[model samples]
Every structure is written in structure tokens, then in C-alpha cells.
Target: MLLTAIAPMTAEAAGEPFDDEAFLFEPKWDGGRLLLHKQGERCEIYTRSGRIVTEKLPELREALADLPVRSVLLDGEGIVLRGGRPVFDDWAYRLRISQAAKIRTARQTHPVVFAAFDVLCTDRPHLEEPLTQRKARLGELLQRGGGILTPTVSVEAQGRRLYELTAAQELEGIVAKRKTSLYIPGRRSSDWIKIKHPRLIDTVILGCRSEPFELVVGLQFRTVKNKPVGRVSKGLTVEDRDRFLQAARELRVRQEGGVQWIEPRLCCRISYRDRSEMHQLEDTEFLAFLWDKQPEECVWPYT
Candidate 1:
């Protein structure tokens, strides 16, 4: 199946802009991107890459076990509450379980809830419709629903104001989507625009690698001598991981099934919070390097 034929917009790409009067702005949640398809008792949960992750979110599976609709597709984020707020870390804990025991532990330690935003299909297919209509239908479906729906403001000025408010609240950021745009399967048109939290960091892509399981990007910081140091692997979008793998394959540089080497490009931005003393490395005596950035870039907007 063609990638574009399935879903149009991703976190990295924003769609086109609509008329000022017809756009809707929504708060971007600081959680894992998610898509849920349900057919009565059975459910299929997908990541942005179309990877099935239903087993990881058993709590959500149980929550939607007996929905009225026989089949439905919805897009949103899976959020886990932390300190009266929904933090991305909580969601990450729920999504990255590898061991059976770890899965059970995650369930008990950090229960999660699905914060649905868009309904792709409902009895009748609705993805191709304008976002305005889809949102209306979604509102009806969630009239008294338990999950949190992303709050939206149709006015651009109000959208910006809300963005500031959310930012002050320490939330991630806001997504401004054109309300009148059709849901094009895979195009990253200008209809959907994402105004991120301004949490930008420059890092170097010192090296690339293919993990034993998931494809990952390896990165490190540039040392004083201008050499890459502190190599760390993992943490990347499936799209990015796949591209990294493809590049490695073309280079034909697989060493005992480890990561491929890539010269630091000094490109890429990341969002991160300062690590606390509890997270400080034991090898370092002082809590050095308040910010962690890949050697490629050294801009830390979130700090």
C-alpha cells in the first residue's frame, strides 16, 4: 500500500492554510500520536508508521471494548496523567514496554487514557470530508465521552491567545488546522499547521544505526577536540528510522548487526526538559551539562 494513500498529515509535516474564517486551532497534546480502529470486540491500534501497538495499550483496549459503533476509526493521542497534568513522559512509559512483566508494571504504575480528537470513519467513511464537518460529527460522538477532546478555537487571533495560555500552563503547544480542508490521504499540504512549543534544540547526527528490533538514529555531542563523544542510540520517528535504515542499506555498512556510521550533519532539533539529579549520570561527579544536545547542533530553545 502506498504511504500517502493511507494518511495525509504527520507530526513532521503541516497541511495548507484555509480562509481565516474557516480554520480551527487545537491544542497539540504532549503525548504519543495514536490511531484507533475498532470493530466491536476487536481493535487495532496503530502508530504513525502503521505499526500495531494494541498490546501495549491494554487499558485503552478495555475502555473501548463495548462501544456502540461496530466499526470506527479515530485519531488522537494516548495521554497518561501526571501531577494533575498530562505529561509526555507518562505516555512514553505506556508506549515503550518490551517485557511482559514490564507491561503489567506499566499498567499498574501509569494507567493511561486516550484523548481522541478526530473520527476518521463512523459507520460511514468520513476521512475525506472537510475537517469542520468531521469535528462536528466527532463532537456528537463524544457528547458525553470520557476521554478528553482537544479544545479548539476557530478564530486565528483567539488561537494565538490560547497558544500563549497553554504555553504559560507549560503545555506542549498548539496546532492550527484549516477547517475547510479535505483530508487528503498522505499529502502534507499547508492546510494543517503546527505551532510547536518553541522547544527547539540543535544536535548533531554523529552516527546512524539499525537496532536489533526498531530502527534507530545514533547521536552524540561534539567534544572539545571536535570529535563525536557519548554515543547514544534509539528515540526517533518510524519514518526517520526507516530512512536511516535505507541509507545504511545503501552504504552496505552493517557490522555484526549494529548501527551504521553517519558523519555529524549538525542538523536536527529536539524537545527536552532538564534532567534532575536523580537522572544524572553516576560517572560524572558534578551535575554537568545542564542541557543534552546532539553534537550537530547547540541551540536549546526549551532551556
Candidate 2:
């Protein structure tokens, strides 16, 4: 319903970080990925799938309304910065809250900021232009210290160093992309790579999901206290999926959305933002399939 569903450029996963003068690095913010659309006085924010979340995030909507342009589409993230960190759980809770009074209270307590990174359009399309040109234009359109919309910080030819810094701060990760790359919607282009933190943790693959396609992963963490952490659908190559499916039939546990639940016997290492809260891990990635270690060995601080 808005701006022809602006598709943000997607990034491929890289095994490790590297340095190249051709590529620029940006700190990957841990929050909801949003494509904010604003036209005249009407503003709407949508997820990658194009679901309208304008009503859900009133503060972001207000910020967009304050933009200097009459019509624009921006690719960025919506984060609730708490103690200098993006607390995603709080953003998720705010998205579902129904009471007006509660929503107002949360807005005052934890305000949302739109971290604009790319400009898809400003009354006209900029998709044909290279990323470097687009980024400069975006900076001109969005003023610093002027609204909730702050442009994401970028570094040149220092992806590895930036990755190390992000890991040190326990931030999500860093994304590197070619300056000459054009915005290719709905495609994971090689020009862009998402390099995850170096930290790794072992978890068990409990099942296979097929509807939207996911790997049901779990861990016996002390914080979660011996429970299934959550599902991990990204970071598995085609070869990994093929091999996993080969041994899946025999380990079936149950079914939901074509998800072949299996016995928790498979263990693997993965990279993610951080630990689980209450009962699940967020933004998970499958790194490898463990063969030498037992599944119980994948327990939290498991030995």
C-alpha cells in the first residue's frame, strides 16, 4: 500500500571479515529492520515483508512526519536505545501493546529512533545510482541532530577492524558493501556481506521447519535453565540443509507447519547477538554441524 514496497538490498554471509578499499563497513544495529515511507504528511513504516507498522510505532511515525522532504523512502532500523544499547525485546513488546495509555508511557520511558542508512527515493527513484552516490544524497536529506532519524556510521577499508570493535562492544556485527553496487531488491548480492561476531556457542538442532523454512535449534542454558532456546534458519548452506534432511526422517518428534520435529541429538555451533531471555535466543545463525561432541555437550556452559 506504500511506495511500491521498497526492497532493501540484502547481504550475503561471509565466513570472516576482510579489508578492501572497494568496500565500506557499517555497524549492524540489533533491532527491527524497517523501510520507512513518508509522503507529504502521511508516513508509514513497514518490515521487510511490507506489513504496515505505522500505528505500532507512533514515535517513529512522528519522526518521519518531521522529515524535511515531501516524499521519501529510507532503509534503516528502528531501535529503542537503552543504556547505549539497542534492546530489541522492548521494541517487540511495544509493537504488540494495545493500550493507548501504556503506549504513551513506554514512548516517554523508551523512545524509538529511526536510523536511516539508504535513501531509495526522494520524490523520485535513486535505485539506478550507485550506493556511494545514494548515501551522500541521503546524508544531505537527513540532517544530524535534527530529528529521530540519524544516519548509520560507516567506515572505509577497515571492515576487519570495525568487526573487532563491534565484537568487543558486544554489538550485533558489521556489514560490508561495495561503493559502486546498485540496489538490487529481493536479492542477496555478493557486493554486500554480513560478517558476524567471532563468538560461538553450541546448540542442538531439534527439528526442520519447511513452511517458511527454519531449523529448530535449542540449548540447555543455565539462564534458560535446560530448555529449547529457539529456531535458527539462517547461515546454513544448501549442502548443510541437504545433509541434515538426509538424517531427519528417523528423528521425527512431532509436526507443526511441516516442521519435522526431531530428537535433540544433533549439536552445532552458531553466531548470534547474545544470550536468551526468559526462554529463547534471537537473531540466530547456524555455523556448523558438530560430530565429535555429544548433544548434551551443547548445554549452556556445557562441558
lDDT of 2: 0.79
In the range 1-303, model 2's lDDT, one tens digit per residue, is 245676667898876889999999999886778998888878888887777877878888887887777898889888877788777666666776768888889888868887788888887888889989999998888874266888899999999999989878767789998999988778889999988675578888888777556787777655553366777878888788888888676888788666687887777888665454343676678888886678777775421
Measured with C-alpha atoms, the lDDT of residue 296 in candidate 2 is: 70
Per-residue CA lDDT of candidate 1, range 182-276, in tens? Answer: 76555677777766554323344445444433322223322232233223333455665565545445444344436455544334444432222
The residue pairs in collision within model 2 are 253-261
- Stretches of candidate 1 off by over 4 Å are 1-5, 11-19, 148-157, 200-303
Q: State which candidate has the highest TM-score.
A: 2
Please give the lDDT score at residue 301 for candidate 1. Answer: 23
| Model 2: residue 271 alpha-carbon error in angstroms | 4.8
lDDT of each: 0.56, 0.79
**In angstroms, how far off is 15's CA in candidate 1?**
14
